[model samples]
Target: MFFSKQWITGAGLALALLGGTPAWSADPAATTTAAPVAAAAAAAPAAAASAPASLDARVQDLKGDVIRLNRDLLVLEEELLFPASTQVALFVSMDVGKLFELDSVQIKLDDKLVTNYLYTPLEVQALHRGGVQRIYLGNLKAGKHEIVAFFTGKGPHERDYKRGTTIKFDKSTEPKYIELRIKDSQAKLQPEFEVKVWQ
Candidate 1:
């Protein structure tokens, strides 16, 4: 008979499931009166079953606690690995981009190709709905550098369109952040892209 461990440990508890000790164990009191022994015998199985249920609920709660702790540790690890001081980040946004359907974006720093990203249909929908996208994150020396970004998408009358914009800025000891913004030019009836640096 493979009895559960919780049932064994409950022997010393208030219920005294097996009348002070388990039946198989050596105990002088094992030969108790029939009435009290019969009552203990009936109560033992119910107590044993309930004990495991409570223990299983506690185990489940502990698993939840461990999962939450793991997530917190991961967040702390990311901050330690990519501290704000040396981090350079770039984000892309739009201001009522009525004339452009974005397809992709390419970034270059100091004439070196850094990253090229292609947008999905849902990503384009998110951007048009005023969501900002982080285009790049990297470190750079504290000096002057040039950044170039290429925009490729469909233009007016479903025409193929491509354009490039550039900026010259000085990276200081602090972190650098740049926003690539695409805005609708109501006067020209076209989309205009610009790179704006955080002051």
Candidate 2:
């Protein structure tokens, strides 16, 4: 008595078979009302099973595209290292006051430590009033560079910071200083960065 849509349809088919219903009747004169009902009743559950399988296949296809995008971002990061002077820009923002502080910036070349700054920590009032900070890395050789930026303020919240956006410099004239900002108390910030080559 385990009655379900699937089980009910299956039972109906079993009964039809046991009664010797010809699945394909060539007899042009033989006609019955049971045949059409049997066909439709068999189709409903089969359609239900087919729909979920098709949907699952589509979802898996989308996941494959997402995985490819992540791989592309990785490749872009690797491509950024080489010698060049260029313009670099970084936009940083925070969600809360505590996460915003001054003088927490560092730049590294090819994993070798280049320079870092100890910024003056701003008061909560100052940040709310809108403060901006900029750092400049000038005359870089064509190679890979890493910039690490974060607040040096004491606390677990202060440890959160943005990773360096890697860059490769060719001969060109671009801006040097990058501008980054920290917004509010969310203990997290992402700085937008741009780099260009200089002649």
Candidate 3:
């Protein structure tokens, strides 16, 4: 009778405990709350974004430099195909109407006096025949040079004129002809000239 009474008491206690348990245990409300919290936690990493702004700027700058370098290389290749020559031509055209050749015509190449003439009106006429006057510069060195022409006008005074041109000498070439076109004879202003060196 005692053993049977003990077993009945234990069974009754187990039933009572099961009946009085918290409602959340079976309703799943706690689990639902925990699911949303876990989702929010998982999304938190997205909020911490990465910009790398400095790295982006550096990449852009490098890209620009590469483009510029490519253009420069193309130009260099074209120029290399027809590299400059050692020989060049020096040409000058002047107005004979306003300032008739009065006398001595002098020109200097690179500070070295090349031509000096004595004044004579007849010398101008002689130049047409190449019998009296010819501006001659023999086998000049390759590189930059300066040309200064001096002439005496109708007046008894001396006047100075300048024409600056750059000369480039290449690896294996003789001088090609150069030209100097005179501008504004009446004004006697500075003149612009171009020299081409060919190989």
Best by lDDT: 1
Per-residue lDDT of candidate 3, residues 1-199 (tens digit): 3568677667766755775323324447755876788899988766544346666889999999999999999878745653445433344444333334344555676777776657455655544334423355355456555666655444313344333344433323544454433333446532333333322
> How much lDDT does each candidate structure score?
0.85, 0.51, 0.51
The stretch of ten residues in a row with the least summed lDDT in candidate 3 is 190-199
Estimate TM-scores for all models. Answer: 0.68, 0.32, 0.34
Q: Write the per-residue lDDT of candidate 2 for residues 1-199, one digit (tens) a residue.
A: 5568777667667856787544444454434766687899999999999999999999999999999999997767534542234544443333344443443556555465656665444543444466444445345544444555444333335654443445543333443444444434333443233343322
Residue 31 Cα positional deviation in candidate 2, in Å, after optimal superposition? 99
Q: Which candidate achieves the best TM-score against the true structure? A: 1
Runs with alpha carbons beyond 4 Å of true place in candidate 3: 1-93, 126-133, 155-172, 179-199
User: Which candidate order results from sorting by lDDT in descending order?
Assistant: 1, 2, 3
lDDT of 1 by residue, 1-199 (tens): 7978687666545336544545554455554655587899999999999999999999999999999999999989866765666667889998888798889999998888899999999998898899999988887778888999999998777888888999998888888889999988989988999989887
Q: What is the C-alpha local distance difference test score of candidate 2?
A: 0.51
Candidate 3, after superposition: displacement of residue 158 in Å? 12
Task: Point out where model 2 deviates above 4 Å.
Answer: 1-96, 100-103, 121-128, 142-144, 155-172, 184-199
